[model samples]
Target: MFNTVLVANRGEIAVRVIRSLRALGIRSVAVYSDADADARHVREADTAVRLGPAEAAKSYLSIPAIVAAAKETGAQAVHPGYGFLAENTAFARACAEAGLVFIGPPPEAIDKMGDKIRAKATVSAAGVPVVPGASDVDIPEGGFAEAAAKVGYPLLLKPSAGGGGKGMRLVHQESELDAAVESARREAKSSFGDDTLLMERFVTTPRHIEIQVLADTHGTVLHLGERECSLQRRHQKIIEEAPSVLLDEATRAKMGAAAAEAARSVGYVGAGTVEFIMSAHNPDEFFFMEMNTRLQVEHPVTEMVTGLDLVSWQVRVAAGEPLGLTQEDVRLDGHAVEARVYAEDPARGFIPTGGTVLAVHEPSGDGVRVDSWMSVGAVVGSNYDPMLAKVIAHGPDRASALQKLDRALADTALLGLGTNIDFLRGLLADEDVRAGKLDTELVDRRLSELISSEVPAGFFVAAAMDRLISLQPTGTVVDPWDIPSGWRLSGPGGITFRLRTGENQAVVRVEGTPSDASVQVDDAEPVRVSARREGDLLEVRRANGVERYRCADGPQRTVWLAREGKSFAFADQEFTLSSRGEAAGAGPVKSPMPGTVLVVKAAEGDVVSAGTPLLVVEAMKMEHTVTAPIDGVVTELSVRVGQQVALDETLAVVSAAEEKQ
Candidate 1:
């Protein structure tokens, strides 16, 4: 085994790799950008090196800087954890040129499998069934319609040079072909530096199943079964599980054999994944999607089920070790499920969120494992991926695993920012999901039902109680005059707190002190409530029952609360404005998240209808288009391309059009 390995990534993946290195007694070196100087991975590694600025192009994605860091740290090998340059063929060759081992597939294999167009041909030649599709070269000039007619409707446009759902579009008919192509090409160029695309038949009700494969220098390859990654949003996977319930033993063996063959055909070594798309209606049929040339984000689920440390094996193979076990020796012990916890808000179209983490509570105990890089006071920014951590659970059966995963998510809490913990719990509790009736579109289909926009009454009550406690005199000073007990010399006093979250607003009225108070939310019946704070937790007692909330005070008088996996950020109206000046006659178009304005679609005085795209804001490699909310002319345009904007910053305004008599 190598004595020192350099981890060329950031966030949870870097922390995860460092953990494996520590377990194997290998010294780990971590590289970080300016934004990640205080990242948990940097603190955990044996040695840390600064690559460059926060911009990924000059830091994490900079091949020269990473290679130099590895050489300076005297690292014997470089482990490209998942994203950034993990699948880049040039990085692999650079390692070889520098006489440092790359703990992944060879450059030739990466090059062959990196391009989706060529990967389909290579895998097909090895007898692995592939989806019927057309490439850019396959289509004649201005012949997209002809190609679509031949391939059939509902086709998928995938960037040949990238994966991870980036630069992918689903076209249901010829009418949507041109726009889809334009968007896909633009995103593809921005993400992968290549706009070349391939079209494939969009399988109805498809289930994403991938087989994990490991290969050695001695040409021995083995499959580690499959993971079901059908639970997704915006084409990105949020939930994954190993030992898919959809596959029987016979089908599992067949898929595993096909996956091994695919790896062997590309001369693949180290850890890789062969992704397949299977139709929910036809379980026996499967089509090859593409092969990831490095360790996957969901590798923990596979590890838990197979009882193998994939990273350790990757290092052993990179050190020129032969296979230590045969295919028959592998046995999946139990089922495992993993839910990705991201710094995003599912209520607002899953837009990325950023803030300082004020508090965190990761679950523990039997059957629960949390691979996280989040810590209190960690500043989460929009400079990179929004994923904060992953919560995985293992059990003897799928039902128990799902149950444990739901319970674990309920116990998890991260205050001071928005997250998808509640959304994940809701997804796991879906009747169809619990029954294993899963498909890629299941989340999208039930998104509205899963997301609750109504703020629970308890949240408002807790916020009021928290404020009431804070208003009381502290430091052993007991002054009856200073007490905010809603007490008066003549009669009882009352305090009112107006709180707002997004479009929802609530007026909380409190009478008396924290121990004995009558709380009423937005004209609702006053209920007896009392609350006490213990560290970050706030215990509130109400007429119904006692509820505990993980609470934290944020900047600008924002109260963050988490209970039962759900989180809320309530802004005290006394300290902040009730609205962002949206009550005026003009409809303001605001940036959904903090990001750079990539494209300005409309200008001042331009008439646009409702839902017209006005600007596109790019953050964390994802683009969200701001559109006109009403049929009117663009009265004001406040931003231009390449300008950095904060969340909810007004980008433009549309004055309502005059009504004709």
Candidate 2:
């Protein structure tokens, strides 16, 4: 066992590795960038080291810096926790050259599997069926059209060097092929420093399944069944489960053997996963997709069913220890499901969101496990992945596990940030998902029905009551005027507050004292309500029933509330009325999030119709186009390509022709 292991990663995976090292009585060292100076992983490790700036190239991906940090800390081994330099063969070799053990497969194995083209070739040579695709590593300019034609339409342009859907583009028509290839190459270069790509047949309604393989220095390899990762958005997995309900015992055995064979062919050691894309129309058929040469973000589901600590095994295998269990000894006990909780908005094209975590209530109980890096007061940023945590549940069967997962998600409370918790719950509750009829395109197809735009009326009521409660004076006073309610002898006695929830505005009127209040939301009938503040929780007793909400007040009359399985933020228009006075109509184009301007599609004096792309902003590695809201002429272009802009900063201004009239 290593006396000290330095983790060359950040976020939840680093924390996970640290916990596993502690369990085995090994000292852990953590490396962090400027953005993660106060991260949970830094606090969890036995010792910590500063890598560099917030940029990945200057920090986590800096091989020399990481190697030096490990050497300075006298770490016997280095663990690359699934991202950053995890699958970098050069980084692994550097650690080995520095006399430090890499807690993963050998550099040779990583090199073979890291490249999608080479990995498919290697696996196919080992008798594993691979998808039919063009394996040409390089394509000359102007040749993409011819190459894409060979692979047929509806194919995928994927970076050969990286995963996580970073450098992937799907094209359904010949017209989209050239642009998709160019975009894929650009993203590939930016993400992996490799412009090489491969074209693969995109199977319609395919199910993503992966087999977890564990290997040792002694050539012992074993498979831990399969995980269904079909529930995905934009080629990234959202929900994953072990012991896929789609696979029968016979199919499972065949896939497991093939995965094991692929591992052995690469001389793989430690934990690696063999991914396959299986057509839903042909249940018994599958093709090799790619192999991830490190621990996966969704490995917990496999651990739950196999009863094995994969991280512990990674360390043991790297230390030249034999895997004690054989193929016959492995047993999958029960069903387990994992939902990735990300700081993203599923309703808004799954855009990444960054904010300070005001509060967090992770679900806990029997059969529920939460692996997270977020806590109250942590600042989520655009420099990294948006994933905040993973909630996993285990049960005796698939149905029970799914039920447990839904309940676990409902109990989760993360305030003051946009998250996919509600979206994940929606996915688990879908009829198609519940019936085990799933595919990679299921979420995208049913996205409209899954994402609810309606905010419950109770939420607005709770927000109103919370704001009113906050206005209470510290001193003990019984006077009605002394309270937040502006009541007078003249006009209506009820005080009306302007609040906005989503796109809907509410005018809430409050009458009577704080203890006994009558509330009327919008134009609805007035309802008598009894409300009391108990610490951070607001208890409201309405005509229907009583409800409790966890509420927190923010600056500028903002209130955040969490109830049931939802978190909402409501802005009070009181401040808007005082400072901004009236709502401004049709302002300039503003950046939604902090990012750099990528493309300026329109210039000053350009006449454009509504919904025309004005400019494109690249933030958090995702591109968002700012479009014209009305048929207008561009009056000013305030931003330039490659210029970084802050959130809400004006990028352009368009004057509507109708406004001029």
Candidate 3:
């Protein structure tokens, strides 16, 4: 085993790799950009190195900087943990040229498997069934239309150079072909520096399953079973599980064999994943999608089921060790499930959110594991991926695993930012999901029912009581006129608070002190309410029952409360008003989230109809298009392409059309 290994990544993956390195008694070196100077991974590693500025192109993705850091730190091996440079063939070759071991596959294997077009051909030649598709190279000039037609409708356009649902589009008809192709090409070029594309037949009812394979320098390859990654949003996997309930033992053996063959065909070594698109209706049929040339985001579930440390094995293999076990020696112990916790708001179309983490409560106990990089005061920005942590649970059976996962999510509390925790719990509780009737489209189909946009009344009551407590005098002597205890000579006295969350606003009224008060929320019947602050937790008692909430005070008089996996930030209405105190109207086009304007579709003074795309704002690799709210002329365009914007900042003004004389 190598004495020192450089982790060429950031966030939770980096932290996870460092953990395994520590377990194996190896000194781990962590690399960070300017944005991650005080990040959790940096604090955990044995040694830290600064790459460059926050911009990924100048830092995390800088091959020379990473190689130099590894050499300077005397790291004999470099582990590209999942994202930035994990699958880059050039990065692999760079490490080799620098005389440092790359703890992954050889450059030739990575080059062959990194490109989806070449991977498909290679796997097919190895007798692994592949999806029917056509790449740009497979067709003659001006033959894209003809090739697409032959592949049939509802086809998928995927970037040949990269994966992760980036630069992918689904065309259901010929009318949408041109626009889809153009958008796919643009995104592909932006994400992978390649505009090459491939077309594939879209499976109507698809279940994404991938086989985890490990190979050694001695040419021994083994499969670690499959993971069900069907629960997805925006074509990205949000929930994943090992030992899929959809596959029987017979089918599992076949898929595992095929995955092993695919790896062998490419001379693959170290850890890799062979992804397959299996039809939900026809369980026996499966098609090869592509092969990831490095460790996967969902590798934890596989590790839980197989009882193997994939990272440790990757290191041993990179050290030219022979296989220590055969295929028959592997075992699937129990079911395991993983839910990705991202800094995103599911209620707002899953847009990426950013803020300072005021508090965090990760779940623990039996059969539970949390890989997280979150810490109090950690600043989450739009410069990197929005994922903050992963909550995984293991159990004797699938039902118990799912139940444990839901309970674990309910115990999670991340304050001062919007997250998908509540949404994940709701998804796990869905009837169809619990029954294992899963498909790639299940989340999309049940999204409306799973998302809860309405703020619970208890939150408002808690906020009111918290405010009432803060207003109490803290000195030994208090002035009568300075007291805000809602005490008066009249029959009844009350104090009202106007709180706003997102676009929704509510007025909460409180009478008396925090220990005993009558609270009314937005014209609702008054209810007896009392609350006490205990450290970061607020215990509130109401007519129904007692509820505990993790609470935190944020900047600009924002009160954050979290309970049962749900988090809400309520800003004081008085402080939320604009400088002029003018009410917002439909004319202002505001950015939905903080990001950079990727494209300006409409110019100033241009007449546009309602729903016309005016600009595209991208953050954390996700793009959200801002559109005209009404039929009007763009009288004021405040933003241009590549300009950074904040949430709710006006990008343009669309004045309503003037009436004719």
lDDT of 1 by residue, 1-661 (tens): 7999999999999999999999999999999999989989999999999999998999999999999999999999999999889999999999999999999999999999999999999999999999998999778898878988899989999999978888888899888899889888988898888999999999999999999999999978999999999999988999999989999999999999999999999999999999999999999999999999999999999999999999889988998989789999999998999999999989889999988999999999898999999999898887898999999999999999999999999999999888999999999999999999999999989999999888898889999999998898887768788888646788878889999876778899899889989999987999998899988999999778999999998888888889999888888774444466443445678889999999999999898888899999988888888888878889899999999999899999887766210
lDDT of 2 by residue, 339-446 (tens): 999988888788777778887788899999999998777888778888999999999999999999999998888787878888888889999999999999999899
Of candidate 1, the 10-residue stretch with the lowest lDDT total is 576-585
The deviation in Å at residue 271 for candidate 2 is 0.3
RMSD of every prediction? 2.1, 2.8, 2.2
Clashes of 3: 0
> How well does candidate 3 score on lDDT at residue 355?
90
Best by lDDT: 1
Provide the clashing-pair count of each candidate structure. Answer: 0, 0, 0
| TM-score (C-alpha) between model 1 and the true structure | 0.97
- Ordered by TM-score, highest first, the candidates read 1, 3, 2
TM-score of each: 0.97, 0.95, 0.97
Prediction 1 global C-alpha lDDT = 0.92
**How does model 2 fare in lDDT?**
0.87
lDDT of 3 at 435: 92
